[model samples]
Target: MSMVVTSPDFRWGLKFFKYLEIAKVNYFTNTTYLANFLSKSIMVVLRIWIFTQLYRVTYATANENEIGGLTVPMVIWGLMIAQSLNTATRPQLSKLIDEEVKSGVIAYSINRPYSYILFHYFGSMGRFVSNLISNLTLGFLAAFILVGPISLSWNGLLLGSLLLFFGYTLDFLIDLMIGLISFWVEDISAFNWIYSKSQLIFGGLILPLSLFPDYLRNIAELLPFSQLFYSGSRLIVNFDFQLFQKYLLIQMAWLVFFWLLVGYVFSKGIKHVSVNGG
Candidate 1:
């Protein structure tokens, strides 16, 4: 008798393809096309407009390089990159997980072939790809119209893309933990709000950390939140290879930490639900 054989990597590739297919289906079936497009367009336009004015006015009399370690174009590009990642990597896992828990549909997910968290991750990537392409197109067009272009070499672009993947994964893991917390909390909105604000304030959303006061900037540098926004955005704008390695390392560390935390909570949550006959 002859038997078929496949490599482990090949099997995993097949699994990823399966989840990606499901994600594509969800993206098309679940998305409200016109509403999503119009809303995203408005958001990108408004953000690009506001930041263009803000940076131009703020840097009017200042030396761009010395003031915030950023020029006007650099600031705009940083914002563009950050916002792209924001829209692209906005994990829908928490909301979906919450709905499934409430509907008692999570039990069905337990029988699924893939890891639940990874399934959600891959599914989010499907939607994210759509959002990323559209958002970047709209955002970069608006940015060019408003501020002209920001130069990034091909090597910078490649490194920045690599850093962005790590940053996005770190963000996804964080979102995963928050989603898993739904097992204990009735609503995770407050937690999400806090996390978003932390990113806004400390993750270099409003301004680069270089522009912040020493104390505040120091704190942000030490936080995982900075890796989500600041590190990736800075890599895009600055593209320092040494800093790239450092931030990539930090993001990897945080990803591991959060992954372990999510696993622990998941195991414990499952036990609790089983005991309660959920």
Candidate 2:
């Protein structure tokens, strides 16, 4: 019998295998999924209880007067919207980047045809999609149970969805930029801690910017963090055309800035080579 042998496409096959391995590792060891579910559940429960207490207090104190131009329903909606829009990507991104650096696998990734930034982008998209589905479902359930069904017009719903998606993309890119700093820094734990805390405060996850003092509110509005939650929540409730345009423009500007920054950092990180002798 005659034998026939064909050479394999090693380069393409290797690349595909590498990506598959990464995906498998990420899927099986996704601790964030459990952590997110637990944390979000606690947050939703605590928030609902707090708001219910506030409503009782307000009813006892004043005879149906407006608090900061917000009725009880509006306040409830604002809280729900803000909580629902409290999306984040950095905690996982930082940990992934730090792991790569510590394990010395980043050197191999740097030598690959694909940019590390793009690799991280793919991994982050996986995580974000997972969280998006989980969080939105939980957020909707919490809103329904606590605030009841909200009546958003079709146009409002469409615009709010668009804004929310764009806001998420912008936030993801910003987190990637921060994660990339791991390439230069020895340890990123402190950076990650500070960044997460800042997000909690400035991203309007704790309280909507509407409740802030005027000066603090203005400062928060100018920062990119506000776009993460404040913009999307405001769109759902208020739907001001002019403000929407402004926030969208701001998101675009930050996207451009981070895109350039990531490019620059990747270029710099790739230039330094440290090959370990096997």
The model with the greatest lDDT is 1
By TM-score, who's the top model here?
1
Instruction: For each candidate, give its TM-score against the true structure.
Output: 0.90, 0.77
lDDT of 2 by residue, 44-122 (tens): 5567558756864775587764554555555566566656445435346767767877778888877777757656666
Model 1 spans > 4 angstroms off: 5-10, 30-32, 61-66, 274-278
lDDT per residue, candidate 1, 109-145, as tens digits? 8666778877887777777777777778888888888
Provide C-alpha RMSD values for all models, in order: 2.5, 5.8
Clashes of each: 0, 0
Q: What lDDT does the true structure give each of the candidates?
A: 0.77, 0.67
Q: Considering summed lDDT, which 10 consecutive residues are worst modelled in model 2?
A: 1-10
Residue pairs in candidate 1 whose N, alpha carbon or C atoms collide under 3 angstroms = none
Full-model lDDT, candidate 1: 0.77
